[model samples]
Target: CWLQQALRATDNPVIDAAVRLGNVLGLPVLVYHGVREDYPYASDRLHHFILGASRDLAAGCRARGLACVQHVDRSGHRERGLVYRLGADAAALVLEDQPTFVARWQTERVAERIEIPVYAVNGACLVPPAVLGEGIGGRSGFLRRHEPGRAAWTVADDESTDIAPYDGTLPFVPDTLEGDLDALIAELDIDHSLPASAAFPAGRAAAETRLMRLIQDVLPGYATTRNDATRREGASGLSPYLHFGVLGPREVMRAVEKAAVGARHSIKFADELLGWREWFHYQARALAKPEQYDRVAGWARATLADHAGDPRSHLESLTAMLRGETRDESWNACQRQFLRFGWMHNNLRMYWGKRIIAMTPDPETAWATACYLNDRLSLDGRDPATYGNIAAMFGGSPGDTDRPVYGRLATRSDGSTRSRDGGAAWLAKAAS
Candidate 1:
């Protein structure tokens, strides 16, 4: 969620320097990124399929009359300017996603360094975060007044969305992914120990298939069974789709509402999740220091200092938990599902996240590791909701401040009641 780490990790000083040059030229330079991880070598998943550059934004940019330049530099068809290269008109800067906190700062700094006006586009959401922010006023104020009014805000379709129709002349094309993706996966230099699950496919077709299936078959069960992790089709398997922006929330909500018009229960749950998304964003924005990871008001230095030495052991424990080898069968089963699929049910994710913080040394390490791994893997990584979930473990979450035993600094668990023997037997059968 934070981009500072990535900026430091970047090898491309040219991106910084060139953008600065563009700014000095009075051009509205749009910095485009496919993968959150910057530059040359990146996991294929990291690189997004571009429109003129990314799949959708190119058409959107051209429709808005922004000149689409494939500024790869060496291709010198025109007078290529530096990082500060600026456009004559307002440029529609299309980023792969919202810049991480570090990326956001660096982007602004680059804008300052280049002397251009940048409108940070909310490309991640079908409806941008800013639009959502506008709808929900300042964080604390919005939630206090509107938390109860969630039904109204979400029930209304985001009327402002406009994905410009694609024109053939656009400079970008969808990445023609070739060969075996599995073989490609092995080459990414990621941890090979974690196996990829076949349950979800890795492209647009896969995303649509899952969504279509859910609308037809699974949504009917959503009202009652969505929370039950054991029922594989219980909940809307739309998290990964929503996370990847493969299916827009408005589109999904509208489709579900249209199809399940008589089924108010499903409509209510879908609305609730969207509202939860708004709720999380409001909480994240409202925090006094949203960028400060792992440290809460009273629980910062002592908590970090207390758990510095044995991170390796903590890592091992977390890895074991991730692998579904822990003592809790219910948690282990959820872990197995996440291990096999890129997601877990929302109900299970809370249980899974709570357990991780409980076993790890400090809240920060636990939160960082969980978030990092999930972001790298889950289709929905790098989302506000995901960030908010990790945030919940620290002191208090969005809707409530009640410190749950899991994220709070404490050692408490009842072996028999929370035991997963029942779940373990089910998971073992499923794994086999």
Candidate 2:
């Protein structure tokens, strides 16, 4: 079993499916996870989080009587064609059914080149995108199909492997991530500028802590406080963990269902977590290219094109935007969250994404800039939800009259974050 994003050992569809197949074939499962220095935005922050989760992954697999190996791509530890070499020994290969980013492209290439039968399992979502089928149009239509199926898919039956761990490996030696991972990551040839996030720690323990926080603190008042950017405990702050598969939706929802909270708050949390997030996953699965500029609505593109020449002011350089030094304090406050903690408030994301249109040279540049900043800085970048939310910001209901740079596409205000008590002070402090 090859895991790219689904890093957890328990309640993971990828690992569970692999174990089932292994049991059927009477062969032990050899789990492999590799980190390369060449993938886009390979920095200390991403590397540290991934390696921390992977270290725990190996330990977890061992506890379950399964073998898990890891390889970190660096100067001396370069192992070319590792996946191909490993596939040579296995009867079949099982990988995560990821739709976007490196995992999707890598798994597709491996399946084409490898001789053994390769199977992809949907591990990222609670209700698999495949189960929903295609051509579901909008979120309401998606919910009609999705909500009905949720009860059946919420439980995860972890498969047990009857066979012993795989001890026969002829490829290169694997890196041991058990101790002093920081020293090893520091020696690697990755971006040292972007440091590890203190807010969202790596490994299963940290993931569980967030889950506890979600049930105890965030869920009770989620309906009212989720939109407030001023409160530190407003949002669950679990997106990074969810994106990396440290905590699957099944496990999170299981906890949420059992938590002692009001129905209104729990239902609202479920809407954002499963309803909105999975809808984006389904939307991205249907698109030919989810990350492209052409994915925006046709009407939105036309209106923006008509008003492309109407821009006269408020253009910030890429460096200023990247460093969170932009003149717009509200946008800067949003960007700084990505810069400092590799995450952002859900409410502020809308304002930050929409404002990029006027802050850049053109509409295409605006889209590219928003994607680059989000994908590069935030831990949850290069995801279906990330692009889907950005696309919604770029293309929504047409306004009564066309505007300057935004045109028919509606414009968002900073009042969502700025109108609250001490909101102005928070923005000023966050921007600095």
Candidate 3:
């Protein structure tokens, strides 16, 4: 099994499917995860998180009796077409069914080249998009079809193989992640300017910590405080882990269901995780390029184009926006989170994204800038939610009134957060 995004060993459909296939074929599953320096937005932040997760994935695979191998593409260890070489040694390849970004691209390329039967398992979602069928309109229809299917997918698929782990890996030597990861990352040719996210530590242990915290602190007031942005406990801060497949939706929902919390709160959390997150995933799978500017709503794109050249004072440079040094205090407050932690509050992300339409020279540049900054700085960037949320910002239901720079798109403020008892102070502290 070639894993690009589905990093977890437990509760991973991709891994389970591979194991089941291995058992059926009487062949041991060889799990291969490789890191390339050339992938889009390869930075210290992504590499640190991925490598740490990879380390635990290996350990977890060992505990589950599966052979997991890894390779880091660096100056001293550059193996070209490693996936093809690995594929030649295997009977068939089972890999992640990611709908967007590098994972989707790689999977398509590898599937085209390999002669063996390639199975793409939807590990990123609780209910796979393929199961939902196609041409589902909007979130409500998605939920109507999606909610019924949730219970069936709730069970974890940790299939065990009777055969021993693959010991005969005849490819190149695999890199050991047990060594100093930071030092190893330094050796790679990725963005060093963007430092590792200190706020979100990588690995299964950190992910588990976040999950436990969600049960204890976050879930209790999640429904009320999730939009506040002032309270640290308002959000679970689990997106990085989720994006990297450090935590699957099934495992997360499993913990959430068992939590001794109110149904309303838990339901709200579930809606966000299962309903909205999966909807975006489904939407991305239907699109040729979900990250593109063209994905913005047709009316919203036209409205934005109408007002594309109308912006005056609010326009800011890419450097200023990138550094969170813009005149807009609320926008900067939202951006500083991305700058420092490589994550931002969901509520703030909406405002940050919308404000970019006015901040940039035109709608296209605004779209590109929003995606570039988010994908480059934030750990949760380049995700389905990232593009989906930004698209909503650019093209929300056409407002009754049109405005400067934004046109028919509705505007948002930090007031919801600021009006909170401690929100103003929180925003002040976050922005500084």
Q: Which lDDT values do the candidates have, in the order given?
A: 0.47, 0.92, 0.91
Q: Give the range of the ten consecutive residues with the poorest summed lDDT in model 1.
A: 1-10
Off by over 4 Å in 1: 1-33, 36-110, 123-197, 261-263, 286-319, 394-424, 429-432
TM-scores, all candidates, are 0.63, 0.99, 0.99
Candidate 2 structure quality by residue, lDDT tens digits, 4-123: 999999999999999999999999999999999999999999999999999999999999999999999999889999999999888999999998899888988999999999999999
Q: Model 3: per-residue lDDT, tens digit, 44-160?
A: 999999999999999999999999999999998989998899888789999988888999899999999998899999988999999999879899999999999999999865898
Off by over 4 Å in 2: none
Model 3 Cα RMSD, 1 decimal? 0.9
Model 3 per-residue lDDT at 162? 82
The Cα error of candidate 2 at residue 432, in Å, is: 1.1
Query: In candidate 3, what residue range of length 10 has the lowest lDDT sum?
Result: 304-313
